[model samples]
Target: MRFVWRWRRNPLRRRSDVVEAWAGVAAVVLMLVLGTAAGWAVGSFAHGALREAVRQQQQHRHLVSAEVVRSVTGTPAEPDHESTTGREGYGRFLARWQDPDGVEHTGLVALHQAPGPADRFPLWTDDEGRIAGRPMDRATAVVHAVLAGAAAAAGAAGLVEGVRRVVVWRLVHRRYAQWDREWQQAGHTWGRADAGS
Candidate 1:
């Protein structure tokens, strides 16, 4: 407590103290901005890259086809009807079928839109006849791009703010130096006058 009081009363420590405080504030703000940008960039990049890699691996690959034995909405409604919509309606599809090698496989595909009950979407399987990956829609790609760009912008803004604060500190320090010199000169002059008298 005594140390804190002494520091608060110390005139020589005042300018340096203000500069240190402002520097700490600038550092915190910069960290927040950079951290947010980095996180967003990583998330966007991972999503797009993984999706594309999976799609490429599945391209030109063939799978045994089968008819939809049953179609039902994802909700709590009972399975009662067949959907006639195009590929756009195929939000999520579950297919149960057998491969050419007499092996059975169940595949799940997530589509941008809902697919019809009878719509024939391509299924890609590995050597083991396991469903590997599916193609991603254009809308999902766009979202990833947007998120990455936003993160870059946030990082840039943080750097700019940090630099601005540093410049402000330099200016404040220069002014404080000039004021200190002036005050010391005035005190010396007063002392000389008192001694002469």
Candidate 2:
């Protein structure tokens, strides 16, 4: 209790201490803001690159006639097949085809349409292999990246703020200690005068 009173009376415990503490807090806040922006930029660039790669692969794809070896139902159905077959489920078809080099390849194809047990279907394949469809557009990929980046930034900001508050509290406590010591020395000198009287 006496220590609290002495600290309150000390002139060295100035308002500037509060200002400096707030300044440190502001610096940390600024770092979090900048980090978030940088993270978003990086994520956006990566997503755009991925989408472009998909688009290029789709553009180079070639169409070929394939024989359906078998047909199987898929879970959660294909959207295109839903309207035609009046069934809301996905379908898978096993197909075999000869490439331009006359090499036979067998793979599974997911169709939006229901096929009979042994129906023929047009298959599309790129130089490397078959793909579901064209790559996603850049705008869609960017939106997803931005959202993910922002979420990460928000989490980081929370951690930084917590650490900054603890540091500031410790600094404030140190300043209070110094002020208390100065006041106690002054009080001791005054007490000696009262004793002599």
Candidate 3:
């Protein structure tokens, strides 16, 4: 890990040693600079896109009161489960709602609790009265952007490290090959009277 000897005027130091030392320094600098820049750029882009999506959804989506017609047992393919907010899906019901454009629609809607006939609950819908999921809130969007940014930063750093390792490996191999060639020449003159002279 020490590069002091590479920089000094040592007879044992090969040119490749100095190159490896400089390569390490460059790799470290690149990792820091590239990681930070990539993270920031990705985070900012994600945040802006998410915010725009939120705005569009809010503008186009509408919340309407849906009246339960009847409850039905969930099928295996559509088993009821707890939502991300930890609310249990007690059952599903055939519900009817009218969109802002006065268009009526009916569909299976999940309820947190057993619903009696004619019971009403709020439901989100699109312009055509089709059911829709809730829009992403600003806070959730920000969190997602941050996580994406962190992943990008780590990815960038990992790529830089991998490149550095590959370069060092090739340099080491080249140095070993050079040593092998020198050893072969030395072997030819081994045990000769002039070998050490």
Candidate 4:
């Protein structure tokens, strides 16, 4: 049968079928308009929030120069593409530094090259004087925001599709039930010679 049969003047078409067709249209509209809008809004919000965090981290953290107390002899972990600039592959070392108050501290720190015991390195520290990595740059913050937006959009569209599927499935069941009843009504006189008349 043609897909538009529900809109045609057919005696066999049921009211449930028409409702299902309208629901299908609504689903497409929602996926296009509401879903896309929701994704864009969430993405924008995420970008702002992440960028703010980056700014705050920059404010709260301070850089301090430290000297390597001992050499890091063991091999360092493989650096991925996202590692800080100049830190291409593998390198980290134990270093010590004094904060603004002259308090001494030591911890593992990543460096572009192995540091000698006498070598001095610059490292970042949070307000509590704990070692910290560089803050999120603008590019990285945007990337994270975009990813979060995409995830939220997919979730919204999936929910709409699921609801559409359930409604259509129920309509199909009703159609089958109607057919079964019709078949039963016509089946009782199947063997009678005058049934066709």
TM-score of 3: 0.84
lDDT of 1 by residue, 1-197 (tens): 53354347565665655555566566667667766666567767866785685476556334556434345456342232223223444555666666657688764554454456766655555556665434445666667766766677666667767776787678678878888998887777675756462
TM-score of each: 0.39, 0.50, 0.84, 0.77
Q: Can you write out model 4's per-residue Cα lDDT over 1-197, one digit (the tens) per residue?
A: 55588778788778987898798889999988867887899999999999999999888777899888775656654354223534466466777887767888886666777767879977888776677777778899999999888987887888999999999998889888988998898889777898983
Please give the lDDT score at residue 176 for candidate 1.
83
- Model 1 residue runs over 4 Å out of place are 1-102, 105-128, 131-135, 190-197
Q: Is candidate 2 or candidate 3 better by TM-score?
A: 3
Model 1's lDDT to the true fold?
0.59
Higher lDDT: candidate 1 or 3?
3
Q: Which parts of model 3 have CA positions greater than 4 angstroms off?
A: 1-5, 74-90
Write model 3 residue lDDT over 133-186, tens digit each, in one string.
Answer: 787889999998998899888999999999989989999999999999999999
Order of quality (lDDT): 3, 4, 2, 1
Full candidate order by TM-score, most accurate first: 3, 4, 2, 1
- Find the number of clashing residue pairs for candidate 3: 0
| Residue pairs in clash, model 2 | 77-89, 77-90, 78-90, 81-112
- Backbone clashes in model 1: 8
**Model 2 / residue 115 / CA error / Å:** 2.2
Model number with the top lDDT: 3
lDDT of 4 at 10: 84
